[model samples]
Target: MYVIHLRYTGALAEIDDALDAHRLYLEQQFDAGAFIIAGPKIPCDGGIILAATMDRDRLDAIIAKDPFSQQRLVHYDIIEFNATRLAPGLNLPQSS
Candidate 1:
């Protein structure tokens, strides 16, 4: 799997406009089973984490479509993970 770290860098005024588009993209990815979970960072850190498909190319494409990226509101770092364990309720897939 992969974890995407999105760090917002633009004006807060654009948040409401960008949020809906971001959520829409995430919802579509989730429905396609390519996304596991996503949410904003607490403490207003201007960041978000997204658990996404394992494929880097696919992840790149998905990130490219994010409103934050389109609007130059945020930058992202993609981290690939090898799931060795998962806690209940996290809904992560069992490692093969």
Candidate 2:
């Protein structure tokens, strides 16, 4: 699994301007089943994304396609880990 942390580096105005394209990019990832879940940070300063198990290079390519990355409005910190457990009835990949 992967944890994608996105922190805004630009002003809110710039962030807003790029939000739509960013969302579109996110939607594409979801459609491709690369993304599991995502949302804005509680403080709205950034966002977090949970992604299914996959190659790091593929994930990096996906991130590079993000509008925020293209516009230089946000920074990404990606962490890869193995899923050790899940809630009852919940299903997700467990391998690193």
Candidate 3:
């Protein structure tokens, strides 16, 4: 598993226009099981974190399609890390 850290660095004016498309893209990725989790940073800091259990190439392609990336509303610094999953009552699937 890996985490993609995205930092938005642009005018806030573009947010309303880009948010919907960005969300749609993420939804598609989630449904495809490529994205395990994703959400925006609170406090309106223009940051987002995405947990992906797929290859960097595929993830890169996915991000490339986001409205934020396409419209220069945000930029990303991807970090590939080792993830460990532990749970008790949660029935989450094992990480690939």
State each model's CA lDDT, in order.
0.74, 0.91, 0.74
Candidate rank order under TM-score: 2, 1, 3
Candidates 2 and 3: which is better by TM-score?
A: 2
Model 2's TM-score against the true structure? 0.94
Off by over 4 Å in 2: 93-96
Misplaced by over 4 Å in model 3 are 91-96
Q: Which digits, one per residue and each the tens of the lDDT, describe model 2 over residues 8-96?
A: 99999999999999999999998888999999998999999999999899899989899999999988999998888889999885433
Model 1 segments more than 4 A misplaced: 88-91, 94-96
Write the residue-wise lDDT of candidate 3 on 30-71 in tens digits: 887777777877867566555656667777787888888989
Please report the candidate that would top TM-score against the real structure. Answer: 2
Residue pairs in clash, model 3: none
Kindly list the per-residue Cα lDDT of model 1 for residues 1-96, writing each as its tens digit.
Answer: 877777778888787678888888888877777777778788664665556445677777777887889898987877887776778777665322
How far residue 31's Cα lies from its native spot in candidate 1, in Å, is: 0.5
TM-score of each: 0.82, 0.94, 0.82
